[model samples]
Target: MLSMKVLFAHLGREHLGVEYLSAALKRQGHETALALDPGLFGINDNVFHNARLERRFDQTRRVLRALEEQRPDLAAFTVYTSTFPWALRMAREFKRRSPRTPIVFGGLHPTFEPERTLRCRDADFIIRGEGEGALCDLAHALEHGTDPREIPNLGFRADDDSPALNPLRPLIGNLDDLPFPDKGLFERDINFRDDYIVLCSRGCPHRCSYCCENALHRLHGPGWYRRRSAESVLLELEEMKARYRFREVMFNDPILLTHRGWLEELLEGYRRRIRVPFRCFGQPALMTDAMALLLKHSGCQCVEFGMQTVNEDLKRETLGRPETNEQALNAFRICDRHGLPFDIDHMFGLPGECAADHARALDFYKPLRRLNRIKTHQLVYFPGTAITAEAAE
Candidate 1:
């Protein structure tokens, strides 16, 4: 059997999805490499850019250069909405250079907008949702010269040059069965000394209108939200600590406090074995005295909460966030009492937002004693999110 060398192209920060897919492919006896483009000049990850500087330093050229050097059998990319265009540009250039080599795209953007993404002539195939299994299958089929279009969760252009999408495969029930992410892929690019990021869970519980989680939940059904076993998570962290000697750990789960029983068990193990200082996100409505205390005792340096709006009516009706303004305050108060530094994620410019909303947010946050920082962002309407449909209406 041919051992396909799969090249994954990514921009800016290290991507956990790409790492996981690479690990899966390697486990199946396929080789993988990363062509990381440090997206400079406001390409995708960073905010700093000068038009002149950007023109002088087209970072995609660097990625293309890597492509020429590696000349892998397949090129893959994991993309989000913000980085879709960049991914396309890179794909088109790769097609231009090596038309015979196939390109596959996966991740949040393609998971939702598979057809639109495949409309690009250069995009040979896309794997939508939970790609580790599907990608490995696709690679195996491709290496053995088998037809790949029937593979679940894969999308490709039909003989008529139209998008042909296969139904999604069943979601992976136990994340522990999968091998640990291929962190070696990004060792040279990422500063593991600062913080080692780990995703201990898959999918978010809440169906927030602005987020794609709801769409995912709709697609995958009730089991959409799943967490890694506490033992699995601690073992990964223990391995990471031994390898990188990381000063800090970052839980990149959508919300770290999904299951109380799991959280308590994880915290207990974390405190005892992997006691490195860490930070994670939690829903304000999910916070409790016991949970906050456990986090503090477990070496959590901070907790971040999404307090998108102070107006309860807008939050529920528009954002679909079940948490009320009082609940958010209670969460803050609980954190403060436990001496847990916390940050507030603030979003302005909702569809029907006004200056009063901003003022009210300011008033709500002004009195919080343990508020580490208020991270502000303008709301972005992704293509298939409920908020985008409502905004159009």
Candidate 2:
């Protein structure tokens, strides 16, 4: 097989995943480079809270120029829902400069809406779901004149009248097989002091109406919520700690403490071995005072609970979260007692949520505010989410 030069563009968080994939490709005897968009750096909560868009077109252009100079055979990009438009524009620009370079799109947006993404002239291919294996396959295919159609989980347009989607591949159950994301790719560009993120697992089991994870589950099958073993996760963490030396780590899993047994094992392992302060997302119902205390002892400095709203009727009937205000408040109190900083996640503009409901959420958050940080955000109606479908109807 011919060696290929590959460039991966990550427009969001510069974490282990991007680095891991790049390293894996390199290990396969391919040259790899990474371009991380500025937005992925930790958001300025102040500016973000104010809903300000700080567009650094010049910086992006400079990065694009550098990538163009590399003249990679293939350019792959991972785009989030909010950053899709900008990512599309960047892909277009990349294609304009290196028209021969195959530009492929992936991530949550492409996984769910491949047809829509294929419509963009710049994006020659879209890979859905877990991309480590698929990306390597795509790179090799392009380098050796292999057929793109045979690549699993890919979407492209055919000469016929319609877009073609390869058969969806099964989710990677043995996460241990995938190599840890390569941090060396961003060692010079990213500073863990300001930004740090990781993902121990993918997909969420909960079917919250407003959540997009459920949609991701439906995209493939019910078994989308897969995770790496505790040993596997710790290995990655050990490598990250030894290399990057991050003071803090943020697990971006929708719900890090989802599986009680797995979470306990993970926490215990971290406590015994690597004990860097960390934070993660959680649900109130799943978190007991004992678990919260264990997490704190295991170096968990913070936890962000998805309180969503306090309107009981709307919480249950509208968003399908079914979390009681008292339950959430207790969780916050537990975190406080354990001296773990916590953030209450609230969403605005839900279906049937009104000014009164917003007021109710504020009232509910009042008591918890003293215990922890409270955050409120406008509901982003993403494509393929239940709330989005409900809103359309």
Candidate 3:
């Protein structure tokens, strides 16, 4: 089979999805490159032009030039709701210059809403589930002139303008079977390599209505959760250390301490071999004093836990989290006792929330302000998620 050149279009953000896919493609004998889009390349809005704007403009030009120069057989994108417009613009521009090339999109936005995404006309294919195996099959079918409609986890438009949404490929049960993500594909484009991200596991225990993670977990059916052996993770880090100099690591898992046994093994491994400073997510309901102490000893610099609202009804009925306010506060007390720096996440503009509710959330945080930092996000109603349905209701 001929080697295909694949180009991934992404915003200037840490998109581990593309990196993982790049690794898969590399293992299957394809060359992959990343084109990081400069954020806020507003095509219509006239904002005050500054040095920052000029620099962003120049970076966008460089990425577009890569499209013309490389002429990749397939151009892919990792689309987020926030970056969908920018991705569409880039895809249309790429297609305009090289109509023969194909455009494939993956990630939460397209995975949940392929119909809406393919409606763009420029998007040629959508990988609806995990991409490693499914995308490899698609590449093979495309190269061999096979029927891609038969491929799992693939969605495309038919000649009659109807959509073909295929079933998802089976989830990779053993995460260790996967190669270490090709960080080089993204690392070369970014300025700094000090802060790196690695996920030792997939799937979250919680069923948060607004969380795409939980929705995705349901997509793969039961037993979607999987974790890597501590040794497997340590080996990947050892390889990463050999290639690049990194100071801090961020575990991208929804909650790092899923199983106490696994967490202990990972922490023990980190203590013995990979002692880089790290931070990870925690859930108030899952917080334990022993886990906090182990994390502190294992060089945990910070922890982030979602406390989306102080409304107990909203937390339990709407968000699908049942941890009580007292329970949430006690989790922080444990962190404070362990002297572990922690932050809390808040959602201000949720479906049934109002300004008073936001203020009430602040009142709830006031007492804990000395113990943890706070960050708030506007409620994002992603398609196919329970929260989106609730919002519509």
Among the numbered candidates, top lDDT falls to 1
How would you encode candidate 1's per-residue C-alpha lDDT over 75-156 as one tens digit per residue?
A: 9999889989889989988888999999999988998898899887667899988898888888888899999988999999
lDDT of 3 by residue, 297-378 (tens): 9999999999999889888998899999988998888887888989999887766777888788778777763355787676
User: Each model's C-alpha lDDT?
Assistant: 0.88, 0.78, 0.82
Ranking by lDDT: 1, 3, 2
State in Å the error of residue 92, model 1.
Answer: 1.1
Question: Model 1: how far is 166 from its true place, Å?
Answer: 1.0
TM-score for each prediction? Answer: 0.96, 0.91, 0.93
Q: Which scores higher on lDDT, 2 or 3?
A: 3
Could you tell me which 10 consecutive residues in candidate 1 have the lowest summed lDDT? 42-51
The candidate with the higher lDDT, 1 or 3, is 1
Clashes of each: 0, 5, 0
> How would you encode candidate 2's per-residue C-alpha lDDT over 84-140 as one tens digit per residue?
886788888887888889988888888878888888766888888778778888888
What local lDDT does model 3 show for residue 157? 94
